[model samples]
Target: MPQEAGLRSFFLAGFECATQRRADGKRLDLLASTRHDAHVAKDYARIREHGMRAARDGMRWHLIETAPGFYDWSSVAPMASAAAEAGVQVIWDLCHYGYPDGLDIWSPAFPERFARFSKAAARFLAEQGDEVRYFCPVNEMSFWAWAGGDMGRFNPTARGRGDELKRQLARATIAAVDAVREVDARARFIVAEPSINVAPNGDSEQAIADAANYCEVQFAAHDMLVGRLNPELGGSPDKLDIVGVNFYPDNQWVLGGPPIPLGQYNYRPFREMLKETCERYGRPVIVSEFGAENTARPAWLYYVAQEVAAAREAGAPVEGMCFYPVLDYPGWENDRCCDVGLFGDADANGDRCVYAPLAEELRRQRVRFEGEFAAANDERMTPLRREAS
Candidate 1:
């Protein structure tokens, strides 16, 4: 282990299933595909150069074993291998969303299928075991269930309230952990979920209750992953190594309150949320995903770094912070996706050689938080004076 630097920077790697690829002369969704692409390996190499020790990659159970008892590792193996070779660690996300297409999510076989895929993935990785140790069984389970199951945003768009989604996602998380432990008992699980602070209408009692419930609701995934269900969720709390928070400005909002424009949301709001999450869970926190769009991002960078420092000073076990993407992704909602990348795009040959100023700003902020080193002036490490002899 690299002496627990107290803060870390990581790159995001969307799994084969979650990637939206330009193909068939048009964009095709690969959220449930098992086929791997060569481009991913190339991308990983580029990402590794950006000072990331950890990479957040997604893994879909549905894609790996599309049919009963059938398995395929071709899609993920290269990227995992690439990460290992590059000396980068991976926090593999299993089952971001959707089923293998034929199976119903409500079916009894869902949990077992997920477990099988996880176990197989863990086994293979362990067989090749280098530094790959962390596993995030599911990413943002509460939001996914709500969006996919309740809100109908993505596939398997079943509409329901918060409870069902919470329950099913929790079960899947449990099964996933069990599977991984079967293969690698020492594997650490990072539970990544959306952390939203719902500011209700004024200080009314109902509003307070609503806010509390909302906190718990967002915590549903973390609670279950660490086995915290208790009297309500019907099981013990699962073990959570890191509480991964995917927070964007949009996620923090008031009930029916006028939307706070993206530029208006500041670092204070994020700091408070980070503090609250730490206070609530009493676990080490990682701002798993954080970034903004359409502005002078260096200012944004300075502000976020200040807030992260505050989180650390306040005694929150904030282990690391990840900027989500090193390059912009095409066609995400509201052009926000395109803007989030630190490197906007590449040259004609797809060779990524330029770093956007925003990335420089990110680097700048990291240095401020981690402290700067003067090449020949620092006293913590130095050579003895030869004149003494």
Candidate 2:
């Protein structure tokens, strides 16, 4: 982990803020649905109590810019103020798979419009007392391209156009970085995408090669942003900063088959994936989003923490791990509750019940990290110790 990243704590809380429209034409606002928007002050304070002095949140572009060239900060101002007041450092997501209505994602003007929005957002955050701004220009570009473009599961439902959608997202991301930098040159960016492993179901040579190729597609967006691939999109190394690898238990799967069991022979160790990402990008990496539902939560966190510890010892620049959706949210497709957060759904008073098992596991991991890093005299441990204490 680089000291320059300046994360306030080793563990981070990620609020579920996806504002995507489903295939059924229903737009979802997770922040609102989870009541985090209304209770942001209490939410930030709660995370601090849990030793998470930093968070990943989002800005709803649709609500902020309801019309062309018009800006509204009413929806975001309170959250920003709460973070500042609670002393929680936030990495804002500019677009979490949702955009303004009537905006054509394929048109040249799409990137242009997003750039302007990014500029405005940067300036606004700066004005709100965020001296050093951190932003994820677009969350999970590869996943979004596949879900909305290739699978027709979300907005702009089109099939067999994943690559084209990915390229356009790359263009938008590049434009956003430039636009943000124009507002504040010191602004940092996190390009978060899902990290996965695809295994061949059979021993056939063609199946093996196909699986490998499919796995490689995960890096297309990162490569594009760094100008390693699709240089025509105007990507350069500067556009790529911190690499955020979003991993879940189901990330590894057999080609054309079901998910690989956790202890299966073909299931890749999370450490190896973390190390590969760091080496591939030559930049700081963070487990930007990761969590499991119900009873699997504690075990999953334990697995990830141990793997991250091993990765760090092996010289991977793993910076931080974010327990995504720190507050449980309603399901995107169905309104059913997803019991995956450290905190349950908010009550009328904007308070939530803590999931004790996961919270205990998180505390244990924090202590373990503090001890290991302290023994190694790792400078990065300083912030963790200070925050956790």
Candidate 3:
């Protein structure tokens, strides 16, 4: 539990702050596309009013470091100040799947530049005098490698080179963490990597082993960060501070097959997944990103909340849950409205239309979780265990 060490609240909202070049070679600034860049203060205010005291937002690396060895705080400083003014605690992401165009991702220069950026960003936030500071240096290393290196979905656009890209990202991440610590020792990091599961479709030995191996691959980035797999890259136990695991409906599937529907015979329980993750890493875990699209959003939260509670009761250090993309935005590929956030896109005044159904469910879960914590005066608490009749 560690009351003082945990986030300002048990729930958090994440904005779509991705700033990256698309397959079409167009640079997409999500904060601008969603109008959050101009309405930073308003967005923070609205999220606070929703009863969430914490948020997950990011900076655009491409915009800030416009020139080599030169830094510009113009775009990011105001947003950080806005969050502080609105009284909303934020987990600032330094590099959200995008870096400067001139810097090659695989080049040693990439890590060098990122480390410098991390130091600068950390100093900026440290000077703000915030009590609790959280950061995600590199978001979703696993997915990014697959998309950018292997699948050619985004930047780097290399094919069949996901592993190489993953390692390069890991190296940069390690460097960034070190640099941040140098500037602000109190800064906490949230290593958010995708949580996934894979299974064999058939009953053959080879199929089962292959499926299991693929499933184990999801932890590669985490292992590297924690000094488990890649000690040669300066990884160590301290590298892994707080782990944030992102899970979605389609996160688990049979290898080379379709998704295993939650609650089905073939599906692994969400509680089991959380427990396994916590046990392996032995650090605090957050369901950092969890939400469904449209009508299923509310139902999805209930199921995830129940599983999180169960995992906590089972002695897993499940710290909290974050409903990511708390604000809706256009799709990355087609710019179509995803309609998946708790609040719709901002109107003319930067006001968002809250989805009543999702908001109600969020309120219910918040009250219930607050009550669960209220009974425990201990900072370190196991989940509220129910008594058997």
Cα lDDT, all candidates: 0.61, 0.90, 0.84
- Model 3, global lDDT: 0.84
For candidate 1, the TM-score is 0.82
In the predicted model 1, the residue pairs found to clash are: 17-31, 149-158, 226-237, 226-238, 227-236, 227-237, 227-238, 228-237
Best by TM-score: 2
Tens digits of per-residue lDDT for model 1 on 1-389?
11232322533433333532122222233422212233555555655544555667766555578588687877678777877776667778777664575666666677778878788888878877754477878777877777767766565556774467667767777777877887787787777788776666668999878866765688766766655564343344445667888766677666667545444542136777789888877777787776665454445556666777888888776777776544555443232335554544444454543335555565565456544532222223212221110
lDDT of 3 at 338: 86
Ranking by TM-score: 2, 3, 1
Summarize candidate 3's per-residue lDDT along 1-389 as a digit string, tens digits. Answer: 33223787788898888877778887878889998888899888877766677889998999888898678889988898898898788888888888888888888899999999888888877888857578899999999999998998889888999999999889989999999999887878888888888879899999999999988888999889878887788788788888889988999998898998987787888899899998997888998899888888889999999999999899988888888888788999999988778877777888777787777677778877776443233233222122211
Is 1 or 2 the stronger prediction by TM-score? Answer: 2
Model 2, position 86: C-alpha lDDT score: 86
TM-score of each: 0.82, 0.95, 0.93
Q: What's the count of clashing pairs in each model shown?
A: 8, 0, 1
Worst 10 residues of 3 by lDDT: 380-389
Top candidate on lDDT is 2
Alpha carbon deviation, residue 352, candidate 2 (Å)? 0.4
In candidate 2, what are the lDDT values of residues 282-389, reduced to their tens digit?
898999999999889989999999999999999998889999978888999988999888888888998787888787788788888655542343222212211111
